[model samples]
Structures are given as structure tokens and as C-alpha cells.
Target: MSNKTFFSLHGGVNVIGGTKLHLTSGTDELIFDFGATYEPGKGRFDQVLTVRPGRETEDSRAAGVIPNLSYLYSPTPSKHVAVFVSHFHLDHVGMLSYLDPSVPVYLSQPSFNLLRQLEVVGEGIGTHRDLRVFPYGEWIDFGRLKVLPLPVEHDIPGATGFYVKTPEGTLAYTGDFRGHGLHPEVTTAFFARLGELGTNILVSEGTRACEAPRPDAYSESEIGTVIESAVRPGKSAFFMIYNRNIDRIATFARAARSLGRELVLTPATHHLFRTLSPEEYRLARPAVFVTQEFRVKGLPPWIAGLDVPRLTVPDIAREPARFLTELPYANLNELVDLRPDGGSCFIHSDGPPLGEFDPAFRNLKQWLRDFDLALVFARSSGHASPEYLKECVNLANPDILYPVHTANMAAMPTPAHGILAVSQLYQKYYIPGRRG
Candidate 1:
């Protein structure tokens, strides 16, 4: 009888029979991702609507981030359990600001650091949420709730899937993940371990399930060959990509070296490199530091003494005349587009554009055309690809598959079996309390 699985508060799950479990037991209730929904019909991030009283409710109605509660309107402390943040993306962590401060929230360390940086860039305010930042192997105890962070790769840093050990059983919540080869093999190895972890009720992210298979991603070396073959000495390659993907940076740097150009690191990009490990920061050694130092809170963490090539923004040229003459030897393309000037080439390291619609193609072409530059896109995504996404579902073999964080939110269909589509309205769900 204790093995019964009921459909309680199933925001994004499928339940057999009609068993509804209230979201509370003892002093804990497991609140999964409370994502923030942006206002509908708006182009980009217009502004953040505060989650107060009538204003937030009104804003949610107007913006279309429906199913949002007024606040932590729960009447009792023992009724609500701790919140588990799947990943660091704003949508997944959106409602972080509005939750009851007494409720414990958990996130990865890197994600927490990135969140802090983002929050500083955002509303310019600190938080009062009782967040406990844990590493991949550590666990947190919230009375009866036992939680652990399992590492995963995404476009964001410190991305993780969670495993919760409750009195009822062990449930794993995959905030967001992909089975793509884009991530190192270690990523898959981690998931394989999760499979052995005996995930009882799996809640996975099926965001790309319905999307068609993307092209085979190129390795950093193969991409370097493309860059070397494409660019001539007189071209500068410019890149645009997500800041969280540190792997792409290493790829570009190594590729630049193979092409005979000293790896050029932008100031903003340099800080990220400096913060990573030596191997992780392996950017074409005999490597050149285009920027001197990365500053955080007015102090650099630690400056490496490794001898590498380097240049500053002001030193792109000598007397503003022979910018080409000072350009590093080898990989420097004599002819190409995306220039700091006539003899410069660029690589748009920044990743693809996100949100409702991507402007990457349009904006990229426009930027190149605006300066009469030529370019090629060498970018890859952090999400899992189709085949891998399929594999994760197959490996986990859950009863239902749910997807989020994309325009085709509901498009990610379940491969396991039948589907019970949660209505787009009210979206109420119930789950039984875990027997202690």
C-alpha cells in the first residue's frame, strides 16, 4: 500500500488513478521549480514586476505568467516544504524573490555565484531567501527532506539535476539537461550514476524532445581547422556566446593557436578564464593574454605567472596606423571579415540568441554587413540534442515526460506511455505525503 503513486499537485507529471496527495507532511513540502513567466507580447525583458499583492496578481494576469500565486499565501509553515532550484536560469529561479523567507532553497555553488552576479546586475538588491548553496556531492537536510545536487551541462554554469530522498521514496528532479556530446563524457557518466541511484519518481526536463535533430556539433579542434581555412591574415574573427559556457572559450583559444594567431581574450572573457582551473583555462598555451587582469570587487583572485602572449584594448595597434603590423603571427588571416580594423578577423563566441525568437542570424548578419565584414558561425548550444534527450527519457523510463523553458513548452511529448495533459489554467496539483 505504501508503494502507491498518486497524482498530487502534478504541475508537470502524470499520475495513475485519481489519488491526490496534499503538498504537505510533518514540516516539509517539496516545491519544485517555481519559474518566472515573462509578460506576453513583450519584445524582450521589459521590466520585472514585483510579486507583492494586487500588483503581482494584476501583472501576472496582464503578462500571461498565469498560475502564479499572490505570494507564499500558504497559511501554515508545516504545510510548505523547501524549494529545489533545478538550474540557475531566470525562468527556473524566477519566483525566488517572492517565496517565504523561512522556506529553505537549494542551488549549486557556481549557480549561486552566477546568480549573485546577475542579481547585482538586476534590481540592484540583495535577497532574504534562506538559500543553502551546496556542491555536487554535498547534501542538505530540511527536517525530513534530504537533497543532493547532481551535475549537468546547460548554457548556464553550475547547472544541476536534483535527487530528493523523502519518506515516501527517492525522487529525482532534472531541472534541465541534454544527452548531447557537446558536454564532456563525464556529464553522461554522472547521469548513468543517477540511473543507479534508483530514481523512484523522475521529473525530467523534455525541452527539446519535439525539436528535430540538430547538426553534428564540431569539436574545438575541428572548428579551429574551419577558422584557419576560412580566415586570411587581414581578417578579424568576432564571436558572441553565452558567458556561462567556459568550454567554448578554450575551443576558440586552441583553434586560434593552431591557425597561428595568439589567442586573444577580451577583458570580460579574461575574467572568466582567470576564474577557471588551469586545465579548464587551457586556452592555447604559448597562449597570449589579450587582457592583463580580471578584477572582481576591486581585487583579482590570483594572477598567473605563466608566460603567455597578451595585448590590451589600447594596444590593438601602434599609433592607430598599423593595427595589422602588430597583429600576432601564424593564425592571423590575411583576408576575412569581422575586423577590429582592416587586418582583424572575428569569432562570434557568444552563443545563439534566446527567448521567444532568436535575432542571432539577423543581428549577426547586420553587424557584419554594417561594417562590411565576413563571418562564419562556430557556436554550439549547452542543451542536450535530440538523440541524447531521447536516451535520457529511455534510460529513466518515467511514466510521463514534461518539458519547459522553450516556445514549444508542451511540445516535448512523452515516450514512455500515455499522457495526461495538465490544463493551461489554474494548474493545481496534489501529491500524497511521504510516510515517515
Candidate 2:
């Protein structure tokens, strides 16, 4: 009845410190996500803003995993071959470069596509990281380890949860998910099948466990309508979302079409959409192409009018504000700078609140206030809410509950299930032993 293990690295509490389950079994050292650490209170941007490797604050990763991996021998001489990234966020894949390149890294098609764009754009230090792309739902074998990529709904396209079958049992890892009631329930049906698998040890995210369930969550249609309504006859829109957010990109495309305007995409985002989308979606390429879409020359005749506003990140970073004045704008009258009557969707698809807070989203809000912009936040996070977290626990009905990806790990509500806290050094957790 003892749940105590000879060795296991339950990551520290934070959105970035992904749970790294290292069993004592032979090279069964599979890392679910090699994310980074985040410490609040510093003026440093990287620390609070993104889960970047060696970001501002103390980089436990940069110093190299000490006591955490101290249990297992350092991964120097012996390459720990199995590394799976549920998604492409910096936190999920930040440590990829740090790991021995010899170890093969696996990511879902969409995620790998997005990561590739980010790397090419010089987004972060991830470019140096090595990775191998696996189609969703495929089973990949690494020595004795068998891994399956389970698609999950997140803000990002190609987001996935993983199902791992070890000698111990079948465990499901929900990388990050939100049951947004959208897309004709395909995603929900997909995840519901996970329950049918009778997965054991359902390790899940507790990021939104502190928040109440948001009813049905934002659906693609509702979001599109809101975004469409916001963008009127003239005004241009600017959204601050990570490049990995491809599903959101699809939503934007549909929304723009609804508004009779072409959806202009950043080259970075187009890079992701081209690779992650279905083979059919590759019929036509966007103007500002990133990676080559399936050997094709045109998009579906249905979307000929649907503009693929493809502008590069370099085009923007050189002069972010200039993106407004140039491409699809510029010569357009000031009245067209934005829709008349003030309709614009100013979305902040980031957390820890990008930019500076206080003056509202740092000074970005301040800069837009004069524009007389109509802000509509039509966005949904990928993390499950507290109610959904409880619902997930009910679905799998696990022997214990271990919530990662949040500072308030202790706050997660796991009534009947045992609270398995992956305590800090010397920290004690009395999780009920798995029933033999």
C-alpha cells in the first residue's frame, strides 16, 4: 500500500514546471514536457511573461536539473531517448535545447509546425532544440516505452494530451485542455474516448482549478461573431497571441470572412497553419508563405475571397506600430485605419498579462485608448476550469490526483481522490498508496 517511489520527479508548482515522471525502471526515463521555471516579483520580463529557458529570475534549468534529476544519473553519457512535448509552448519545450540533442524529441504535427516557425523567426532559444514530428493519434515506441499522442483542445492548434502505457499501468497526461463548446463537438468526442480507455493515473493541469467553470466555454462560432462584430468596414486589428495558437487563427480567419474583410496573417502564424492543418486545407497557399503547403497552387475556390493576410514577423518587429500603417493599410484613409463607429477586437491571448499591468496591459492599453478602439475579448484558455478539473477527476476516477501547472497547487479540489503533491525538497505529501 506504499505509494512511495524509489524515484520520481514531480515538478515544482508553476505553469511551466511540467510534471517529469522518471521511474526507476530501465531508461524508462520518459520526460512528458521539458518546461522551464517561473518566479514572480522581478522586473525581468522573461520570468513573469513567458516560461523561457534561462529567462529573468533564477533558471534552475540553466543551472541544470540538480536535486530534481539528482535521483537519476545525469543524462550526460547515457542518452535518455524518449522526450515528448504535448504542445509547443516555451514552457512545454523550453528545456529541449538543454537536453542532449542525441535524445530524439517527439511532438504532434501541429505543434512541431508551430515550433518550427517560432524557431525560424528567432522567437527564442528553442531553435537550437532538436525534434521529430509525429502525426496525432499515432503510437511511437521507444525501447520498452509506448506513447500515444491524444489530441486535446487548447488555445493552440495541434495541442495534445499523452497516453503512456508502462508496466505500472496506463496513465493519461492532459498537457493542457479546455472543453470549449465549439467545432461541432469533434474535440469533446475525442477526449470522451479517453475515458473509454479506462486510463489510470490521470495527471492533469490545475491552472484554472482556482476559477469557476465558465459554462460551455467560448465556442468558435461565438468567438467569430464577436471578433467579426468588432472589426467594422475599415479599422485594422492587432492581436497579441503566441505563434502556437493555430486554432485561434482558424477562428480569426472565419471571423474576418464574416465581416467581409480578408484575414491578414503574420508570416509566423501562417507558417504554423500551413503545416498543422489538414491536407485539404492545403489546397491554396497564403500570400506570405512560410513552410510550403501540400504541393498545391491555390486554395479552395470557396475561399478565394478569404484573404490570407501573410505578413512576416520581421516586417512587424522592425516596426510593430508600422504594421498598422503599412500592408493592407497605409494608403487606406485614416477612417479605414479602423472600422468606422469604432469596432476592433483587441485580444490579449497571453497570460501573466503580457506587457506591464496597472495602466492596463502595461502601456499597450494606454497607447490604444486614444485610438477609440472597441475592445472585445473573444478568447478562451486551453486549461480546464476548476469545475472541469473536478469533472475530469470524476470521469477517469483515478486512485489519486496530482495537479501540476499552477502556483496554488494546494487549492485544487480533489474531494474523494488523494491529493498527491509533488513537494519541494524534503516536502512531505501523504498521498494514499495505490491500492494493490
Candidate 3:
């Protein structure tokens, strides 16, 4: 009972997204990042072949998606169990709604706030009523153990890593993070803290851990410059990007302001901006609102009620250079309305599709071709490359490293520490120097 143990419920040897891990000290337990994995194309279930709401637990078990954790969701959990969400990425927090309200789920303050905003914008899947705020950079006592939440930088806000101090030793869990986003120092500071704590076991994301080290990865600042360079004097600039990426939005806003153009946003995106950083909304050039006629169907009263000035397709078509608007893959139909000038530019800020075989990319390409809009890739990956991953492993200098969040662990370059441990699902591994 004195020993500290870890169980890799998911994301141990596989690249699947539902990263569920259980840590235990005596009778107390904590589940980290209970989310769903990504299924390429359509596997057991998809948007069309949906899981019934009332039977998600049974259906998920049958489909081999989430593991059986009925104990955590029981009317009274036998152990003091709490679930912590790392971030708001769909692959990371998609399954949260299925968790029973009896089990307390925790997330960063900003993430909780953003989740509320997303709910208002109709992006949330189900109700998460038992959710609690997990404060960052502070240690919270859980029985005999103490867990410290450390803020980390990612494409999305409220990303975090955790350090759990048990009687045996400390376990460092690096939630999805990258050093090239808006603030690289956050990661740098996290590495320094890990070194000081002498983290015994490190669970790190190896998203790009298989790729070769290259200097071509652009920092967030570099992305802004690339966007600025592509905006010709009289050509409209429309960017297709991940709407949740706040740093990218800032980059686009900065570039558009420099060009003396106002940034245009869809209702959903504007809601997200206002919820996350109202100050940025004020500092940035006043944005022009546009209704999403097709994607969101109709503009809800919440959107129509806003006092911001509205811009119609006719206004944008008349002076294409006066605005920079976002166009996602789902909303490509807007191209028909804007009828951009021949020289107008379309920046594909979102990287290539998950695989070349994806049909969505093909559709996007055909649309761009038909519209005569040149596609320019002005984007950087949100994950660190393999070489930098090795550097991070060495910097932490943990006693053992378990790499997750990668498709090809076999192709991963070995870290300098030479302590990569191949963890398996459901196997309890006790850290070295266990307490008697």
C-alpha cells in the first residue's frame, strides 16, 4: 500500500487519442485526461453512425473506445477519484460528457470558461455539470499526495502539465504542448521545474517524435510575417485555419491591422475571442462581423443581437482588400458569395489533411482551383519535431520516459537518457525506490 503505481489505460503503446492513465497512492486515485481517440475515416463509429446518448458507456465498451471505469462513475466511488482534463482538444476532451456526474472532473479556469463559451456557441456535445476548476501553478492536497498543475503553451489556451508528488517519488505528466507557440518560455520554465524536482517518471507527448529534426518549423512570430508578406495591396486575404488556435488568430489580426484592414470574424469565432481575451478584442482593430448562412445554418439571436457592424458579401466583394476573413473547410460555399477578385489570395494556414487520402482536402483543392485562388501554406505545426523531443527528454533527465501521442514509437529517435520504457495498457508499474 505504501508503493506508488501507474496504470496506462490508453495511449501507452498505441497512437490513439483517448489518453487515460490512472495513478494511485494507497487508496487514493486520480485519472488523467479521460478523452476519446481519433478514428481515421470511419471505423466502429463516426458522425453518421453515432453512438446512442443513453448507452455511450456500453457502446463505447463494445467498440473498444473507452475502458471500463464504472468504479469511477458509480454513485459512490470506492476510492477518492478525480479526473483532470489537460486541454480542450477534441481528441483530449471529447469523452468528458460521458463521465458520470458523481465523478468530479477538473480543468483549468480558462478552459472551463472557454468550454462555457463553446456551449453557448452550440459546440459542446453534452452537459458537464460536475466539472470543477483546477488552478494552475499550485499544489492541491489529495489525501496524502499533492498534485501541482503547471501552465504550458499550446495552440489553444489553458493547456497544462501536472506534477504529482507521492510518498515514493514525483511523476511528471507533460500534457500536449509545444515550445513554438505564443510563449516558448512556458515550456522552458516547465523543463527547469522538472529538473529541480528530479521527476522520476515522465510521460511526454511524441506527436512529431518520429520525424527528423529540421529548422524549417516556423515560430508563431514567423507565421505572422509570412501572412503579412502574402497580403498584396489590392488582393483580399482569406485564411483557412483551426478556429480554436488563438495564437494564429492574433497573428492574422496583427497582420491585418498592419495592412490598415479590419479583421472579419464569424459569429462563433467572435464569441470565442470575446470569452478568451476581451482585451485583445479591444486592442485589435475593430472586427467586422459576418453571418454564417450555411455552416451555422442561420444567425441565432445571440449573434444578431451583437452591436458590432455587419459586413455582407456585397460589401466585401466591392472592396476585397479592406478585410481579412477566415474561411474554414466546411464553409467553402462562401466563395460563391464573395466572388473574390482574380488576384485575391487564399492562405491555407491549416496544415495538410491527416492523410492524403482524406476527401475533404480534395474538395478544398477543387474549390480553390475553381475559384482561381492560389493556396499558400503559411502555417507551423503545433507539436515539436522529433529532434526537439529528444532535447526535451534530455533536459528533463527523468529516471524513465514513456512516450505517448505518436503513431510510430518504433521510428522515434532514442533520447540521450537511454531510459525509454515501453508501457503497456492496464499494467501497473511501480516507480523505483518505493516506500516500504
**C-alpha RMSD by candidate, in order:** 7.8, 7.9, 2.9
> What are the Cα lDDT values of the candidates?
0.50, 0.53, 0.74
lDDT of 1 by residue, 248-277 (tens): 666666665565655555434454554543
TM-score of 1: 0.68
What digit string (tens of lDDT, one per residue) describes model 2 on residues 1-436?
Answer: 2323222444534543545544323554566776654434532343345445544223443343322443222345353446677776666666555554456677787666666556654664333345688887788876555778877777775677877665556666778777653442444544466567755555667776676555535654566666555554444555545546666666655554455543444454555566566442353344452212311454333233446644433433343322221121111222233332344435554433443423335445544455555544656666666666666666655555566676676767663544454434223322222431
Residue 144 deviation, candidate 3, in Å?
4.0
**Reference-based lDDT, residue 418, model 2:** 45
Show model 3 residue runs off by greater than 4 Å.
1-4, 213-216, 285-298, 351-357, 411-415, 433-436
- Residues 322-423, candidate 3, lDDT per residue (tens digit)? 898877776678889888877678887864353355667888888888998877778787777666666677777888777777777665545465477765
Question: Against the hidden reference, what TM-scores do the models get?
Answer: 0.68, 0.70, 0.90
Error of 1 at 95 (Å): 5.2
Candidate 3 minimal-lDDT segment of 10 residues:
286-295
Native-to-model Cα distance after best TM-score fit, residue 361 in candidate 3, in Å: 1.9
Give candidate 2's TM-score.
Answer: 0.70
Deviation in Å, model 3, residue 255 alpha carbon = 0.9
